[model samples]
Target: MRQPRKSTVEIRTSFRGREAIVSGAAAALFRREKEGGFFGISVKLHARVRLKVIVVNSVEYRPDVDCYIRVPDPSNATAVAQGFAPRRCHVDDFS
Candidate 1:
């Protein structure tokens, strides 16, 4: 069992518009604590990143296999966004 960390994350799918609204990535971890407290690690996903992954299904699908879909990447992209200026804006005007 790994210790869970507190962090906020938002995962979105690229295939269509599906999304997993999680309070924190740590909530996804499943573990037991020796002192009776649960422990896990959380993942902080970026707001602009997307990712495509296979997710396992239960009851209707096989446990060994799973389905996949495009989702938001778990990395920060604010810097990238800041670097790009609006299409209407003139690059030379800033200077």
Candidate 2:
């Protein structure tokens, strides 16, 4: 397993207060803390001037696949609250 080097991400995710383990990104040698379905990373972009990029929304992960996926609105608390939890699947439900 690869640990994050000087690079890391930590977000306070709360699904009844728990953690989102990013074993998938771990392959990419990146580790992060997931909370409210968001992970924060600290990086340095050296430039004569300054550069700023922004993430204005939430992030979600799929532990079943060990990766992050895009969602319409990650701010859905009831859904995002499933961090590090077993997914509730229905045989009739397919998305």
Name the candidate that leads on lDDT. Answer: 2
Off by over 4 Å in 1: 1-32, 49-95
Considering only N, C-alpha and C atoms within 3 Å, which residue pairs clash in candidate 2?
12-35, 13-35, 13-36
Instruction: Score each candidate by Cα lDDT.
Output: 0.30, 0.36
**Residue range 18-38, candidate 2, lDDT tens digits:** 564446765334222323344
Candidate number achieving the greatest TM-score relative to the actual structure: 2
- Per residue, candidate 1 scores C-alpha lDDT tens digits across 6-50 of 656554533333664354653343212212232222223222222
TM values, all candidates: 0.15, 0.19
Error of 2 at 26 (Å): 2.5
